[model samples]
Target: MIAWIRFAVSAVLIVTGLVSFAAGVIGNCRFGYVMNRVHAGGIGDTQGLFFIVLGLAFGEGSFMDILKLALLIVFMWNTSPVSSHFLSQVEYYTNPNLYEHMERK
Candidate 1:
């Protein structure tokens, strides 16, 4: 019974992660703005990968596997934001027209 429950939960989590990834892909193609595309892809890369790794950890049900997965998640959790922020900074510094969209007081 416990095994079956674990399997079910793991399956659901993996599916949800896949859906998030799909949404990110779709969003990247759908959005016109550079920042928007980066945000969309970053959401999928971080959240989707986290969920997938989490599901895999649950399925493995071993301390070592879980530890490794946790490390991977932690690494990604830290890096993804920094990367997205860097990209945004690059766009802001390079794209002179960015301010055109803003209203002056």
Candidate 2:
């Protein structure tokens, strides 16, 4: 029974991760601006990765596997936002009419 429960939970988490990735793809394709696409990509990088890794960890029996997955999640959590910020700044600096899309204070 416990094993079955674990399987079900892991399956749900993996499916959720897949759904997050799908949403990110849709958002990236639907949005027009590079910054918007970067935001969507960040969703997949962080939440999608976290869910997938967490599901894999749930299915694994070894402590080391779980530790590695946890580390992976931590690494992404730390890096994804900084990467997104850098990309956004790059877009902001390079785009000729960036203010056209964004409202000026």
Each candidate structure's TM-score, on Cα atoms with residue i matched to residue i, is 0.90, 0.89
**Candidate 2 lDDT, tens digit per residue, 7-53?**
89999999999999999999999998888899999999999998989
Residue pairs whose backbone atoms clash in candidate 1 = none
**Model 1 C-alpha lDDT versus the unseen true structure:** 0.90
> How many clashing residue pairs appear in each of the predictions shown?
0, 0
Candidate 2: Cα lDDT at 49: 90
Give the runs in model 1 whose Cα sits over 4 Å from its true position.
Answer: 100-105
Q: Which candidate's lDDT is highest? A: 1
lDDT agreement with native, every candidate:
0.90, 0.90
Alpha carbon RMSD to native, model 1: 2.7
Predicted candidate 1 versus true structure: per-residue lDDT over 1-105, tens digit per residue = 999999998999999999999999999999878888888999888989988998898899999999999999989889988999999999999998997644454
